[model samples]
Target: MPQLEPFYFVHLLVWGFINLLIIIYLNTKYILPRILYIYLSRILISKL
Candidate 1:
């Protein structure tokens, strides 16, 4: 079998951390509020 390279693992770790940070930032900045608004609006409309 051919020997696999090692640096690929380091690159994957760095990108994974960066992607996780972006997901957390997006959830805090945008997705949470948008989801809340949609949920609240549906409940409000149903109550009428």
Candidate 2:
């Protein structure tokens, strides 16, 4: 059996933060623009 150590928790926390940042960056780079474009297009269509 393996014992849990403090460093394990620290590593997990660091990796979790890194993964979160990557997800946010990818979303902002790709998904966010498409979402904004769709939203703005809908608004423009409604106006016209």
Give the winner by lDDT. 2
The sequence of per-residue lDDT tens digits that candidate 2 reaches over residues 8-47 is: 9989999999999999999999999999999999999999
Model 1 misplaced stretches (Cα beyond 4 Å): 1-7
Q: Can you list the residue pairs that collide in candidate 1?
A: none
- Cα displacement (angstroms), candidate 1, residue 10, comes to 2.0
Global lDDT of model 2: 0.95
Q: Taking the tens digit of each residue's C-alpha lDDT, what string does model 1 give over 1-48?
A: 234556777789999999999999999899999999999999999999
RMSD of each: 3.2, 2.2
Angstrom error of the Cα, residue 6, model 2: value is: 0.9
Worst-scoring 10-residue span by lDDT in model 1: 1-10
- Deviating ranges (above 4 Å) for candidate 2: 1-4
- The superposed Cα distance between candidate 1 and the true structure at residue 8, in angstroms, equals 3.5
